[model samples]
Target chain A: MSINLNRFNRVNRKKIFNRIERTHKTAIPQAPKRPPLLHPQLDISALTDIFLSKFSASSSTYQSIDCISLVPQLVLQYTELHNTNKTLVTNLQSLLTLDKSPLDWPDALTLSTPPATGEQALGLSYATTAIAETGSLVLCASKQNPTTVNFLTDHHIIILREQDIVPNIESMWKQLSLSAEHMPRAVNIITGPSRTADIEQTIQLGAHGPRSLHLLLLAGD
Target chain B: MVEHYKSNPQGSASNSTSGPHQTLFFKAQSSHALLDNTLQEALKKAKGGFIEKRSKAIADVENFESYKQQAQLVKNHTLDHLAYYLTQFEDNLIKNGGQVHWASTPEQLNNIILHICERRDAKSVIKGKSMISEEANLNAALEAAGIDVTETDLGEYIIQLAKEPPSHIIVPAIHKTRQQVEALFRNAHDLGDRELDTIAALVDEARLQLRQKFLNADIGITGANMLIADTGSAMLVTNEGNGDLTATLPKAHIVTASIEKVVPDLESASAILRVLARSATGQPITSYTSLLSGPRGIEDLDGPEEFHVILLDNQRSQMLGTPFEEMLKCIKCGACLNHCPIYSAVGGHAYGWVYPGPMGSVLTPLMTGLKQSSDLPNASTFCGRCEEVCPMGIPLPELLRQLRNKEHEEHLTPRKTRISLQSFMWTIQHPKIFYWLTQITRKVLTNTTLSQFFAKYIFTSWYNSKELPKNNSKGTFMEQYKKSSKQKKT
Candidate 1:
């Protein structure tokens, strides 16, 4: 009943390896590389105003607030407002911080990275809009940026630049293709949080992933 | 002792073929008694967990709807030309140095698997959770042939220890409580003084126990989620990674799957994967989605040497070209089970055979003879929930109704019930007689106390869980309508 492994050894290994290599090579295409820099000395107030206007179109829940004074306050409010479970906030805080015990992270999260420390959160970046079709997230994780900042946190606060919003999944794919590297190492399009109904169909939010998603659409300054 | 040993003359003879009504009545009573405690517990615990998790999982993805649609389209496309895809899949499997065996019936399938085991001199077989194997009763057949078979999936392993069939397709031990599991484990395995109170501990114990069997087994048996025709690969998606070990560790790996599992390519497989886990376990992706091609190559460090796929038709190919073809699109994700009210109440085993929930209600009578299992098709409330949540968009309620119509047309219904319905129909056609009969029945029931007693005793099944409605002493609505019409004419 045993198959002759020696017969297919050389040819099969070559075929499999070639296929993997080909897929990897063709996965990303070379593009015009740009420095990883946020636009400096930009009119933050004007950008915030535009973001707010777009936010109102998609969601009716936004309220007018002073951009300079209310930014941090609104962040806290939105975080609490979006998250129903208090435990998620605690979990997120622990995950976002560096030097946290690895055991505190869930199995799925642990598979991705070890627990993060407090200093690591300073390097994290966020993006708001992602194409709904292909499941590619608009993220800005860099070398100084630990991958854990985006994934490990219980509460993910994504501030969408109003102009960055695309029409559909195809548009997002187009945008992703414009990147210099062609494809990021990982792109997680998260619509919701970590959840499981395995306990008996009772959807306990934040089972193993983010329990809440908050979108801060900055409107006209 | 006499009561236990004596076979009642009224009882159905083991050899005699009886109508579905008699068989249903006997089996229903027996199963009711057997499942009373189990069903109550299962129903109470079935809801809340999976439902919430799925919604959260879907919420995480903005394009969950599109993914679901793509998955549905892929499944529909595959099912539309299943015959061609099945042939392609079989051919590819052969080309990859694997064997494909076709079985038209469960008996034939059981024999084919047993033959494989015998030829390989398989002493112990490690199996992943396979609903198809359950449908074929393969384990019993193997055990009967004096072979040791172990179910490796955590849920399947738990149910196997209890010597019971799977209660849920995804989580086979959905019905068993922690206490029940502790008792089962205590009785079956020697865990010493280790605490079995927590869910984690029980899972750990089962993992440790099954790990050894996975390493030692001569043969590994698993079910395929999708059989990719273009690539000659059998795809298995699991959260625990047990299926990977089962398929790779054993010397010979045997896959039991229906003919409709074939998909066109990896893209189609990926599309279906998006919905499969979300619908079943509410994960974006399962822990392992292993695509196993023809055994291990020389360069491969680990994998089975011999690969055999037993493609069991088991009435599925017959279902093709028929009105029931949509059923072939089922991926066995158990989403319908999670949403089904009846399955939520009675669980899988109460259906009295393999395959349960809405899918089982349609499939059982088709696989087993319609005459022997006619009640299953009629057992539905026709809520259409199963159809609503089905990832493949299978019109389950409509199909169930069609089967019911077929059963009625075939005269498989009991003679007494048929005659009663015929008389009722005749009375309805003759309105005067119908009204007169209705009034008389209402008057008799209202006036006589004995009538209530007779109804209570005679129609016990109807009144068992519910109180009888109060008798309508008022005349028929049609009679009153006629009087009003006459007055208007005057």
Candidate 2:
């Protein structure tokens, strides 16, 4: 059954707002209002350095790729280095494909078509946006780019555009609201790969998700 | 209430009751905890890490006060206008094809979850760490309904396997040593002839097992660190990424959040996020901080089909417009717990509740009747460290004193304490008699010859556990001050 919103509000209204009512008009001081901020302008290109260095400091690796033609070679190189068999790539559902990249790719590149049963050693995803302030990648899950592709695999790789990187998280929200009517179900703001410091409080990466996150930063508008 | 569930072949430990939150009897529990070598040893390892890491994180920022102020301001303003924000979030979430449910009590929350799972014919549910869920006793409730619930956070998973409650908010299995965990795995995981000696091996094993569960679970439940009113997004920050997997994998994703977690905008959320990870784990940022609003969109390839947000108000509304209002600002960073000497000494289980440490002292008493948990407030030495280190600037000691005052008002404390306080107040009113009595007693008690014998006789019970201070040979400070002044005049 759906929640009884009217009943819920009716019960909580007295308990919640009544308390606020008493305090709102009373002697308890309020924070002095400040003018709304206009966040400063910065060279958007310079954010690449900020994003890459910060991302790397958190143990995530990043590199620049000139074209999608080399994506297959990169995937093969990554698997061979890690001593793995297959790489789970997303639906090739990114604008990177729009830039004259080949329609066909390597044999090792397999689609996460039937949903991964953990046989794939690596995952490649297409990120919608990346934030410079925290050096985070923003992925909005759609049928083309499944949420499972981000979490289930051992190594998670992303293809991010330089122009798509926002200056801060607030701007990212503005970007999301622009497409608000068609908001994706899950907006995963991934800062780094999976990690845990639970055992004796010492951090160990690759807890339940990917061990390492590799970003292929495309340095073009 | 402390009933045990029968163990099954799946190897998931049958929970013995929900958890061992001893809401009452803080004194005895803490006493037992204080004397436990294992807990103290674990504490010895954990104590320095949180403190040092948080301080370093705080120091890394140039002006940390701005972040703190921003967080405090957002929380204060939101609480002041909670109705407006809450309604905005509800409208936004509903507009996004998501439903919001309100639970005035823990039982209501449980029923709502059960209804969803049962309707969906859910056989298995994977859960991320939610303190509110623990407070609601949701695990036991779900299991009683025969839903296969798995805890996905590493610490939470360990405690679940051992059938124990979390000892720390961030690190649920903070009380567990590696050796204990090894034994637990040896007992539970049928890794026939597998050698699991190190923490790494144990983590890898849990990863392997939980990965299977994550793929197969019907529904996923998680706790939200913050809920954005503007976007209708339930925000979760986790280092493990289990929260992401849980919310992403299942056919339905349910977010259990307290009413106070609602924030007005994304900027406000950013302000809190800057301090949250640093204070909790000293990280610049957690690995995963997902903002899940609705279920999978019409064109989405993979994600849960349905999304539900459960807003729980478990006695937190009673706190509003009161002296304890500031407490709701707490982000559950466990900074207060880490810096707490009392918590460091006795550990979380002794406090006997979902919350432990200074915050728990105020909460356990306030939420679960002050009289039942009168000892919780008394457990603190009131060193004020909790307030000093609290990221939200909660006045913890003052709140404890408030509980202690309530105890006295209700006569929850023993008659002997009341009589002693009354006598003390009576003596203070008559200053001349108080001086005379004090001076005479000082002379008699400070008599070096009979002092030890008299002290031994008068404070027998106290002497059982502690040594009396060495009797001062010098007279009272007032007498010495008078003599010094006379000599100075000469």
Task: Give the whole-model CA lDDT for all candidates, comma-separated.
Answer: 0.60, 0.79
Top lDDT: which candidate number?
2
Residue B464, candidate 1: C-alpha displacement in angstroms: 1.8
Docking class of 1: incorrect
lDDT of 1 by residue, B1-490 (tens): 0011111112223112111223244337434844588557656776766777677778866567677677777766665555556656766776767777765445556777777788889899999878778877778888888999999877788778888877678888787777787888899998889898866566656656776787689999999898877656687776554675677668899998876788876557767877787888776555345556676554343456788887765556556546677788888888888888777766666666667788878876776656666777866789988887787888999888877777787788889779999998898999888888877767667765756776678877766665756765465667678888999999
| lDDT by residue (tens digit), candidate 2, B298-391 | 6777778899998877667667767877788989999889888888988988888788888888876666666557888887889999988877
Error of 2 at B348 (Å): 0.5
Error of 2 at B371 (Å): 1.4
lDDT of 2: 0.79
Error (Å) of candidate 1 at residue B407 is 1.9
